[model samples]
Target: MNKLFFSAVIGMTLFLGGCMLAPEYDRPEAPVPSELPSGAAYDGSSSSSEVPLVADLKWREFFPDPKLQQVIATALDNNRDLRLAVLNVERARALYGIQRAELFPAVTATGGGSKQRSSADLTESGYPRTTEQYNANLGVASWEIDFFGRIRSLKEQALQEYLATEEARRSAQIALVAEVARVYLTLAADRENLQLAQSTLETQLGSHDLIRLQYDEGVATELDLRRSQTQVDTASRNIAIYTQQVAQDQNALNLLAGSLVPDELLPVDFASVIPPKELSPGLSSETLLNRPDILAAENRLKGSYAYIGAARAAFFPRISLTAAIGTASDELSGLFSSGSDTWSFAPQIGMPIFDSRTWAAYRVSKATREIALAQYEKTIQTAFREVADALAVRGTVDQQIAAQQSIVDSAQTIYDLSNELFTQGVSGYFGVLDAHRTLYAAQQGLTYLQLARRANQVRLYAVLGGGGNLEVAEADFTN
Candidate 1:
């Protein structure tokens, strides 16, 4: 008899295990072009034969700077925002475990003793009497059998949510790497500008002193002396401005790193740093679908679909089972004696007949699933736009940098010629002052352009989701 009952239980478990009500999932079509947009702004080579996909490239290999690699590593290890993202993944995992536990019955062991006094009028002995009882049992409490797959659907939703959280953590890590690299590059450029300003100020001060001596001997006019003094003041003011900018950039870099950054890791000059090698963004835009954010969105959509399955199951009858087997006696010593055994087996069936809430919930779940589908498509579109914008900048930035460099070189030549002409009385000091001003502005502009070019490369790598193998491990928040 026991073997027949055990076989029946096993058969039922197997039958219910295969009953999933959720619709089969298929990935939606990507909402982007078949290939990257082509024009003068995207004139770069797209030869897949020569270049590896950006997503396959490790960040350390892309950056190639020891200090920058170290800074990125530190940010991955300690950045507060990234840490929070990792913690959220853990929270989701635990929630999924909780939902998974619902598939199994909760067994509990219970033991108790009770004593009661009976009134003389009610007692057959016609005197006040006391009754004592002791009991011990093992029982299962309201375990839903999941005949309609309601519990299974909810468990699937939780699993997808956990997966979405994991992808979100990866997205945060990639962004952190890109932001740290960009801020470090900015700091390096500002420091270079500060040094340039100091050098220019020193040269201007020497010119001012020379003009003052010439004026005292009536060889130079007061106008020339005042022009040189003005140049000196301008250079000094620029030095102060660059100094402030450098300090602010350092603070920004430190914030991204989530701690104080050591001076040794800071770049000395923008020119000394080697920018990341240009990546060959493939003609096909399908690779953007592999981005962590895109994957997270799709998982969220799947979770919403699972929720719809669970809501639909709510309209079906729910079956629950409760059972207990134990012994009871008037004395604790006799609780397990022969003839004292007691047992119970109770199964419950509940069908929603008059409940309007179940149908309302089903509608809400379907609406939520539609919203998730829209969001998933939107994520893909945003990613495509970001990659296109970065590639557009990437295609033209090198030429822009080269043109700015030429402007700086020509300005220097003109300034040198004007100074020689002024000393020989062939040109006025006003001509020399104008050339000096133009050269200073050109040099500053060139520095900023170089910084932008380098920063753009980092941005492109990030949008392409290129930092997955960056040697930074996921944070261990168990501590």
Candidate 2:
């Protein structure tokens, strides 16, 4: 018996040392551009790798408008989508825990009671005899011997999958933050434009009234009165259009907040505040690894690699050891007798010789791992593209903003001069009306330009993965 046991151990060792079935996994390289396009220059702001991701940038620091900041805070706390994201993270954690436990052995207590009766009629001649026997035993059974590393590799794969899920949740959260902030900025800009249109409408109405008075007193021609009225009506119609836009923007903001009429108390008005300061761009590509989605992709790739290792291990011969130790007796009272005690240890091996099924499964796992690697690369490239595009747009926005500001200044000057000429009876009402139209266009452009700058800054943080840890209430969350 001792010699047989030694032979079995040696056989198990030899089989495991032979070879495995799955392929080894290595991280696939990303096929990104060798360098940024010539137009890609980070001139908007400089940043350090330590710059917190957009999510990390507190609402107070980025949006100092007390009212707007309050609104952001409320949305973050109450958004239902955010709540779902938190729950997904918890689920991933629990699933990971379960997978990890599989690496350990399990013990079970087995009990059985049996009774047998034999009848003999002709003993040696296959006769039957009247006899009865009762047997009862209880024992512990277990099986464990991960000689091929299958269980270990499986557990590792699960760990990576769990991490990937967590990253997915974080990525969703990052998008939510950016969306909410973007909507808020949009609302503010639109509100200003709406007010501008309304104010211009009022001024035009006043001018029309003055022109009508002059026409009746024989000081202005009928054409001048007609032109003034046309300008007044056009401006009023435009005001109504902008008013509708402002209302629509507010409604969208309400939806993002996951509420109707979104807490009216949350700050809504900031009196033409300057845009956020330009931030610095980082010095290395490694900075991108900070994005939650990117991290999640990395985790997923790792999990795929582990799965390949496990699948390869599956092709190899697997060995398992089972042990049983318990007591057995003919009577319940003698269940613990010396003769009732017994123990057994057995090892088993299974190897496929010509099984197409195993081969097919292993190949499928390999293909899946390759797919995951490709996807990981794709995600990285997309992230880089987003950052590059945002940076490129930023480089030119400042110059354009400066130039547009000039246009606005010039338009204002032209409108003022045209009004003066009319007051002095030196210009026609057509000139004044045309000048006001130009001014209105310039004003709207300026509002859009300002909003664009803020958006670019926010995008920088989003791509950089700048969020801080959240303190969750563990009492209500189960992992």
Candidate 3:
């Protein structure tokens, strides 16, 4: 009879496991355009079929620069922010495991013997006697039977939270890679600027010496000598500024890389870091759904729905079971004897009758779910804006760079002619000085344009979810 009763309880617990109180989840509509924005600022080229999607391109393939690949690899291995993101993911997974374990009963076993003395006056017999008892048992303790699906809903919520953390870790990795690339490019541009300043200083020094000789021979005015001296001083000051800037850029790059970068791996000039190939944004904007941050937001929204279900389940009865079977006897040797067998079966159910707190909790869960939904929609909108901004820059950066280069060429020609005419005594030193200034400014502008072009490529690649294949590897903390 006891066996039959226990079997019936187990069957009921398993049968009601599917009874969940949470409402079904529906994904919120994306509050953005289905198509990517197109305009004069956006590239209209049909490269969607010609090039691989940015999502499909690995970071190494997108960069293709061996030195940069090594530097990024080192950053991925050592960066502390990325390391913390990975740890958060692991912690969420463990929490999910703990929540999942609540769905099953915890069984235990016990065996013991006890002996006690009884006083004659207390026993109603005029004699003192010893009493003995022995017992053994194996059964489940008080384990909640999830008949209302509260435990299942909680477990689902935990699972979604774990998934969200995993996506967050992936998002962190993508940002880290993009930042490292940008810092690396900035360092290269600064080095190029330093070189430009040094070269300009050398040229100005030569011109100053020539003007001084001419002034001494009464061939050039004192004003020409002073102007030449001023130009030399300007170049010397620029050299000092650029030298400091270059050193600061290196420090920034080292911090991003999480270690000192070797000299050979560092960029030598503004053009030393080649821009990555143009990425295809695909025909539609739906690709943004694959981005890690957006995915993480969606996961959180799902978790919120699960939480609502758990809250609703709290209104229903909570059932639990506790049962034990054992043998008891006055003599230790009779513990397993015939007719010494014992059994027990217990079942309990509880429901909140007048608890206002339960209703408040339920209301809070619904509010939280609404908040999550709003956040998910906002994330998608933000992603759309980012991609659009990147495309706008992409369409115009190359043309801007080309125009600046042409200006630099024109300035170089003017400076050469002015210097020659001044030396032949057909023109004043003023023209040469003015031309030199124009050429130097134009060269600096061209370098800046080039850097902007490269930076735009990295941004577009990142916004498009490039490097999807590069999983953030777990850090080994055992050492």
Candidate 4:
């Protein structure tokens, strides 16, 4: 009987190690165009081999501004959202480790001692009697022998989930970097607007004082004085509005950074904040596959397939083992003595008979797989649209900035001509007032256009999956 049992154990080991019931996995086709769209909106912006792809570039290299880089680094270190993502990755990794340990038997050790007294009626001698016993054992208890790959499938699923969580952490960091840059640029632009408002207020105040002086001397009309007052009031109102916007932008930056931003790192004006380096979308839309969010979605899809494998394996027979080798003795010191050895082996096999829940579980796994497939496709589609939109903006922003600059120049010239004519009595003061209004509007428009141009660069970098190449190890939060 002992020899037969040993042989059966060896045979089961070999057989169980060789079988896997999980279905084969095939990656679904991407649901997007092979190439990006091209036309007037995307002219001259098509990907070229010579152009540098955002994927190869680091965040520091893409954003050359020292202050902005410092701010982004601070955010990476302190942002609560990013910290949570890192923690999730750690959690998933730990779960994967737990699932993997089930592939092998868990051996345990146990020891016990007991003393019991027998009643007088139970003793043959009609007297009370006492007995002592001791035992020690090393054994495996009901360890499931994975004959149909169920444990293996579960392990695979856990591994994929862990990978998916790691990708999510990368995605969070990438988003944080982009958000910091966006808010930084916006703060700079608002500062510039405030300065412009202040300068216009100074100019309008001078014009208002001159018109008041002339009206007091009976040389300027009441209408002219009132018009000057209106210009001054308009400039004053803008100053107040822009001042509030700048404060709000600063608050936003602080929230993203998760701490107070240093004064030295703040942008003084739009022109002072250097433009970020340019990036290319590459010729093929396949680049989107490398994006962190898309990769995360794919990992989830693979995990769902692994779940289906586990579900399928549940239909097969389950084998378990319970075995022990130990020594027992009536005397306390003789527990490990010669001739005291004892052992036990128990193997069990259970076949599924009549449970409706098993079939329902299989159906649920199939439904999960389909859902994952659709989500994977949707992620790819969303990534494609983002890149295309950024490219379209890239194609036309420069022209818009150039046109706005020209308008400022023309308006400045008109304002100068009108002022000269009014002083010489060749034109009315209303022409001068209209020219001032036109020039001020043109200048403000130019500032906004420049801001848009710079913001587009940041957007393109983000959409193309730049800024995720930074290496990050599992964070230690024990402290």
Best by TM-score: 4
Q: What is each predicted model's overall lDDT from 0 to 1?
A: 0.86, 0.70, 0.86, 0.87
The candidate 3 region of ten consecutive residues with least summed lDDT is 470-479
Model 1 misplaced stretches (Cα beyond 4 Å): 1-16, 469-479
Quote the positional error of residue 8 for candidate 2 in Å: 4.9
User: How should the candidates be ordered by lDDT, best one leading?
Assistant: 4, 3, 1, 2
lDDT of 2 by residue, 1-479 (tens): 87988797878667864343335555555566544334336554444565444444653565555555555666677788888887887887787677766555566667766665555644665766443333443333344456776766776677767677767776776666677667777777877877887788889888989899889899889998888888878878877887787788778777776775444543243245435544444555556666777777877777776677777777777666666777767676777767778777666778867788777867887788778778878888998888787877778788889999999999999999999999898988888889988998998898898889888777765665645534333333221
Which parts of model 2 are misplaced by more than 4 Å?
2-30, 33-69, 111-144, 218-230, 259-277, 328-339, 342-346, 467-479
Give TM per candidate. 0.93, 0.81, 0.92, 0.95
Error of 3 at 211 (Å): 1.8
lDDT, candidate 4, 1-479, per-residue tens: 98998898779779777676667788888899898878999985777677678987899988999999999999999999999999999999899888988988999999999999999999999999999999999999999988788988888888888888988998888889889999999999899999999999998898788778878998789998999999999999999999999999999999999999999999999999878987778778888888888888988888888898899889998989999999999998999999999999999889998789989999999999899899999999999999888888888888888888899999999999998886676877799999988998898888888888788788888777765454434233111
Residue-by-residue lDDT tens digits, candidate 1, 134-213: 99999999999888789889988988888889889888988998999998898889989999999999989988887888
Pairs of residues clashing in candidate 1: none
Query: Higher-TM-score candidate among 1 and 4?
Result: 4
Candidate 4 TM-score over all chains jointly: 0.95
lDDT tens per residue, model 3, 251-326 = 8878878899999999888666766777888868788988888888988898888899899999888888898998
lDDT of 1 at 451: 85
Q: Sort all candidates by TM-score, best to worst.
A: 4, 1, 3, 2
**Candidate number with greatest lDDT:** 4
